[model samples]
Target: MKGRILLVEDDETFRSFLQTVLEEAGHDVLMASDGLSGARLIKGQQFDLVVSDLKMPGKSGLELFRDAMRDADPPRFIFLTAFGTVEEAVGAMKDGAFDFLTKPLEDPDALVRVVDRALEGLQRSRDYLALKESEAGGLPPEELIFAGSAMQPIRKLVHNVAGTTANVLIYGESGTGKELVARTIHLLSPRGGGAFVPLNCAAIPENLLESELFGHEKGAFTGAVQARLGKFELAKGGTIFLDEIGEMPVALQAKLLRVLQERVFERVGGGKEIRADVRVIAATNRDLAEEVAEKRFREDLFYRLNVFPVNLPPLRERRDIIPLLTEYFIRRFCRLVGKKLKGIESEALRAMKAYTWPGNIRELQNVVERAVILAQDTVRAVNLPDALVGAGGPAAAGRDKLKMVERDLIVQALEQHGGNRRQAAEELGMSRRTLQYKLKEFGLLG
Candidate 1:
């Protein structure tokens, strides 16, 4: 919980001593000899807490606190007052100051304890706000996001990187919850109090992509109705999640790379440069290295966004968590649809676990929602999709059906690529070795 602290005291010796103590206590301490300088710093920068002597030259601690209160998110204040001025410190507390300390300090541990409490309180407030935001956005709980043994390493990676300003690149198949991971990282970050803006790179048209990212001034293009702020501007002091980043045009990748390099960008058709001041978390389902080798994506941009890579395991890889996720989504959709169903039947749940969820968790959620709507009491094999029911029913028949379907898919891919194993593997989203093994398994090697 180390934090940036502003310490203001008129007495040079006392100020230096206080700075030394706070610094030793793991705070980044900034000192100001008088209240005027403290006010200037408060106006120009951000701090977690402010510690100022109640009586100071020029502005006075009370006046500085009052001035700082004008900000929307002002730092918490702790005033230092002499025994005679204890009443004034109490009054400042009534006016929104965090707490106050009497002069002729009794113990250094007291100051450290108070500062720790204040920082912890600040963190709690941020966490609460982030929680509200996530709830409003329909985000799942943190435990659910990190559920299953396969995600343990990913959870650790997220925890390690969330505290820093590094760019995060999440790689996973489509519907594998890349945006969910991005939002989780944002909520766990120092900037959680700020906005979390997300944009799908592939969803936006290439013609309008630049303006959507950097914004556009009035009359920037054909439709010149009014000025608009882009995702970067809206995400200031926070994070911007670029989903499906591999779909971004190569030309736009260069602009994004520049923003990462220089920390600045200009509005479309505008000359003024604005500081990025935004953490970037980009996600893509495609093999970016292959895309780069093919010249579809820029190598430089790829390197810039790939600072911290997190690859999410697809739902099929984590079949052990199917029941957990199914129960979660069942409860969630039940609440949404006003259903009082108990839960999915054992056979229905077995069906889900047997099916290869090509669309991952998102597809599973959709299926559960639909089943909840259709089920009268509890979800059963009858209420589930045909494919799932068949897959879970009569083990021999299910296995034969799955094998036939898989064999057909492999044959089609091979035929489409004129028997080129490499091209067929690429088309099927599998390695050539895996395709070769599958061919042998299906007796298609001949």
Candidate 2:
């Protein structure tokens, strides 16, 4: 039950005292003096929990909690307050703070008990996020919803090899849910009770990617103030989904191949070897064989990871499932956004069916969510993007026409959202980074 924790308190003596107690209880503790300092650390690092004083210099604990909530996955927060601010602390808890404690600790064991409870809850949350469907009685409903004939064999293959411990490599384009396939395998495997840690090889920088996979000891680098566990360590006795594996740097590929061969790795700067008892599931959109021929990826590593391959067909190839996916996304988004939508109109559905999805399932989900948000009771053609209207397919138009349509949609979405890039991107069913790139390409962002 050991976890990394962050403690924030203005009282220097009390901070040291609490750190001692937590560390003695087998928790890795990081300390900050005040709310501002704690906020800075929270933004830069990931922690299991945050313990901070409700009232401190500069920002308050509540403000820090709000900022932390901006992250896609945020740590639990526990606020400490004096008797005079009990009401304020309760308000913070109602606003989604994990728990609250009063000042002047009488029972030392109370802190230990609270910390234990918080970490236990966090473990459950992490497991739930990773194994939402598989942990349930069986595979998730979405996995079964692919009723198309093309998906029947893929579904059978998932069931056939899911219970094994062999490494898996999934080949598919972006948005085809490679991670979903990996999760299904893990959930059905013997390691379902353990963690399912996913790392995007392309998302992280090359300089830090090694430490992220293998971890680092204290003073391993300039910012290495404390020892940290890596994704492999966290995923011990479970599955590690190495997403976009083809994008991993060539230097790191050698180390990864070593892990597959030896089942061991060393910390970034530490000489001690650690055991890795985890199953690896890698996914890529690129033809790794071609990359190997080009000498961009290690040939040994490619063969090691491709022990059992699963290929996912693109959305256009499985067009029969579009309606099913569209319906699924509509229900999900309506419940998520509290819209109470019925369904997409016939015209909209026809247009959607005709348009070849360039971004595949991910783009479809985004479009459906946006349509749900903009709809009254039923989604209509107006809710969809211009390119999707009266389309034979995405590829039917030339590259220039597609670009013009995309630019127009981006401009309209931006204007509708009053120039808020985040909202505009969300509406367009794309990432903020993608939106920025498009804006730059179209000369829209002045």
Candidate 3:
């Protein structure tokens, strides 16, 4: 994507020419006549990339670089040096300069390539900061696992909403990976370079929850020794992910609604109006409509938060993606504990496939990670926990019974090869199946 660039140069003729070149190259360029003007303009304007001269009056390019870092989100900087000094240029780069262009302008292609790389770094910085803000200041979604077709629309919605400061409400089952979704959206957005503040409405006590969301002034309450900015204030220009938002008190919900609608709030004990530029992504598992009808949840607050509802499906329906998720977790856990597993066994895979995971992907992840950790050597079928064979639900419960029914046939093969199923199954075990069927009437299997 083309990015906005703030170009600072003292030479009028050169500045005009460079602007035309960048414009023709599909970049939106803002030209400032001097470094001081450039720094002043940067305070009000948000640019993705910055190109400034090395030496200028009022403030030098290096000084401007320091100032840019103080903004809500700073731009990537490229230095233009007319009387280039190696020491100064190197210093500029060490101070976060994207690149330095010498007095003798070389290939414009090289400049374009530098700009592209700088923009990528800018994007990475943006994404990191945004995810951080959400993680630190919001009601973070706690579940790390996600499932169901519900995610497809959620993904698209995140892509659309990440660019703006709109409040979002995500609805799903408890283990539905709502926080991960919110973080994903924040990372994909332009504000991804900001903080991601998270809070759990249900976890905090009702009395302290409001103060946590909107900080109290010093000495405002019994423990109010220091003034503090709340989650919304801390997450300014980024995202605030409110997890289990349905659990918020009715009175608190009104205040939350005001913050969403007016982009303003007051400290718990202070009357100062704080303008909130923070994006909100709230999640809940409760049926909000029923809660509203029951008078447990505020109807106005519910309406305010119900901007976009994303419902995640339970694991049973999306069986197709199970294997993919299984591998994703396997690789993650294996690397975490410092092991390299080749793969799983056929019978074991079948056992897992038959399971009806009530706890969903989270349950599956724990089971797999446990299996990987318990394995004696390279992870395989036997390495799989015996519990997985009979854990989870009905399918697991029935697996052992079915195996008992298949046992005599297993023994016949084991016997044929002098107690080795490998040889016996390759030879007379097929005949043993016939004999074993009649033996089945005698009820001798495992």
Name the best candidate (by lDDT): 1
Per-residue lDDT over 190-224 for candidate 2, one digit per residue giving the tens place of the 0 to 100 score: 67667889999999999999999999999999999
For candidate 3, the per-residue lDDT at 416 reads 62
Q: With candidate 1 superimposed using the best TM-score fit, by how many Å does residue 305's alpha carbon deviate from the native? A: 1.1
lDDT per residue as tens, model 3, 296-346: 899988887777667666565556566767766677777788888876666
lDDT of all predictions: 0.89, 0.85, 0.74
Q: What is the Å distance of residue 3 in model 3 from its true position?
A: 6.9
- Relative to the true structure, candidate 2 reaches a TM of 0.60
Provide the clashing-pair count of each candidate structure. 0, 0, 23
Off by over 4 Å in 3: 1-12, 16-150, 380-387, 391-446
Off by over 4 Å in 2: 1-146, 393-446
- The TM-score leader among the candidates is 1
TM-scores for all predictions: 0.73, 0.60, 0.63
Evaluated against the true structure, the overall lDDT of model 1 is: 0.89
Q: What tens digits encode model 1's per-residue C-alpha lDDT throughout 1-446? A: 89999999999888888888899998999988899999999999999999999998789999999999999989999999999999989999999999999887779889999999999998988776776667556667777888899999999999899999999999987788899899989988988877899999999999999998999999999996899999999999999999989889988899999999999999998999999999999998777886797788999999999999999988988898899888888888888878899988888988899887868999998999899999999998888878777775586485778789989999999999898878999999999757855774565855
Clashes of 1: 0
Question: In model 1, where do residues sit more than 4 Å from their true spots?
Answer: 1-104, 107-110, 132-136, 394-446
Ranking according to lDDT, highest score first: 1, 2, 3
